[model samples]
Target: MRECLELAPDAIEVDQASVVQRLGSSRTNCENGLFQESFTAAQGFLAATARPRCVVQTVDLATFAGLYDGEGSNDRDTPLEVILERSEALALFVLTLGQTITDTIRRLFSEHDYLVAALLDGMASLVAESLVESLETRFGRHIAECDGKSTTPAVLAYSPGYCGWHVSGQRALFSVLKPNEIGVSLGAGCMMRPLKSVSGVLVAGEPEIHDFDPGYSCCSGCDTLECRARIARVTGPVCAKREVAWICSDG
Candidate 1:
């Protein structure tokens, strides 16, 4: 893992729509009132404050098993196990906007500016997601360069605590990759220290899996109200209107 590794990405473009979605607003709703003010402020805060960083380690799937299984499993089937079944190699990464972002959030909360805090939170998440997307882009190009195939490679990224994988298993990720190098640490609760950080594995060349979009903004599989907004935008039917009614009714 140490012999062949890529340092965390430096910086990435912030996706405003995704940030607004994370703030619980749709593309249309993001255009007005507090949502617009918060969105603009969030963009400014990100422009001045966000410090995007990421680290990627390329290893054989077998090495991944040795690291993950050796640490421990959550009783539920580990996603690494599934990836190992199909792939010979995988990319593991830990990414975070520096601690300053979290510090800003704490200060915002102390100042009772909850709206801005929430907006900053969304901005941080979007930056992390963008980092992951950057990794996918680079990995696909790397694979294509090595294989020289006309078709682009397919890669899947999965994180802990989602898709039935237990959050406790995140310890194994920290074990193999030195999150400390990128200014991240693991808490006792299996959470990343910077709070806005994300860690996950990227699996490539698995024939069993069909979809290979390495990023997600909104979907039914997600629990965010933005999923309903996405559905309504595309299909003209509001499947989860009640789910997001509170946002409209909020004081």
Candidate 2:
């Protein structure tokens, strides 16, 4: 089944500390006037312009693998590939904080207001991610409910530009997800317009399935090994295991 979720702006809880950290500054160090001003401006922009929307469609492993293989330059052997192989279910999702935020960021940049622009951009990214996290949680709950299982599946999202997935992979993803329904468009190099948008596959299965050593060829060049943190989120007690029988339709 396919689901289109329209999220209220207030539903996205943006962590100010995380936004500050993304800006390469900590909350303690952000007491300076410039940082304070930029952050306040970013909050105002978010409140006034943010509109979060997400679309998700579930697909069987075979179909998901085809999309993965279609991305020509992608590393076939990687943790993401292994995780997908082990997944009981998969869903492709795309989300955006709407075009207004993107336009605001660009306008700020054009006006040489780089500080506020940076802060807003960072907050938008965090907001987009929070939407993804919410979707993951919802999908996990849906899986448990459908299966009448007591244990909720562990869900983790993997994007085209991350791990070993080639950025060009977004082309195949967009072809399926069709994020344009939510005013997001694919541009040159498979980059999504509304620059604050995010697209990826949510993998659901046993928590242990997501645990893997980051020793693949793709790991060498990675500066921020975010996979470790992502994996940690899902590692825990064993749960009932079953292959999801649901097949996602092309929406």
Among all candidates shown, the one with the greatest TM-score: 2
Q: What C-alpha lDDT do the candidate models reach, one value each? A: 0.62, 0.82
The sequence of per-residue lDDT tens digits that candidate 1 reaches over residues 1-251 is: 33222322233456677776667776886677886787677667766776666677787766666655533544344334544577635788877778888899889889998888888877777667655656655665567777887754555566776644567768877777877876788888788988888887776764344222323322325564332332232234432111100011111
- Which pairs in model 2 have colliding backbones? 58-248
Candidate 2's C-alpha runs over 4 A off are: 236-251
What are the clash counts of all predictions, listed in order? 2, 1
Report each candidate's C-alpha RMSD, comma-separated, in the order given.
Answer: 10.4, 4.8
Model 1's alpha-carbon lDDT is: 0.62
Candidate 1's error at 180, in angstroms? 1.2
Cα-based TM-score, every candidate: 0.73, 0.90
lDDT of 2 at 230: 75
How does model 2 fare in lDDT?
0.82
Error of 2 at 39 (Å): 1.7
